[model samples]
Target: MKTFEATARSKSKVDTYISNFMKLHPFAAFLTVFVGGPLFTLLAVAAAVYLIALPLGFIMGWF
Candidate 1:
């Protein structure tokens, strides 16, 4: 009986905490896509440029 009561109280506290967090920072959730999307695209472009340049650089070294 005591264990069940404690569990219920803990769950309620967690629920309240999550609700407060969401209310406080509603935009926090979308921040990942807003920030991460551009960062990932830049890394991809840098990798592509490196890959394309390696072969051309090697071929040019033969000349």
Candidate 2:
């Protein structure tokens, strides 16, 4: 019962903190999803392409 109370208190604190952060930095969140999402996707695609190309280059004697 004490542990459950402590856990609830901890969760409430975290929820309050996140709510404050979102209220203060709504645009930061928007930009993170809007710009950061595509940038991360582009980086992931580039990494995959590089990985695929490396073995192909080696197999084709281009390395």
lDDT of candidates 1 onward, in order: 0.84, 0.93
Q: Candidate 2 lDDT, tens digit per residue, 1-63?
A: 999999999999999997888789999978877999999999999999999999999999998
In terms of lDDT, the best-performing candidate is 2
What does candidate 1's lDDT look like per residue over 1-63, in tens digits? 999999999999999997888678878745645876788899999999989988898999942
State the weakest 10-residue window (summed lDDT) of model 2. Answer: 28-37
Candidate 2: where is the Cα deviation over 4 Å? 1-21
Off by over 4 Å in 1: 1-28
Whose TM-score is greatest here?
A: 2
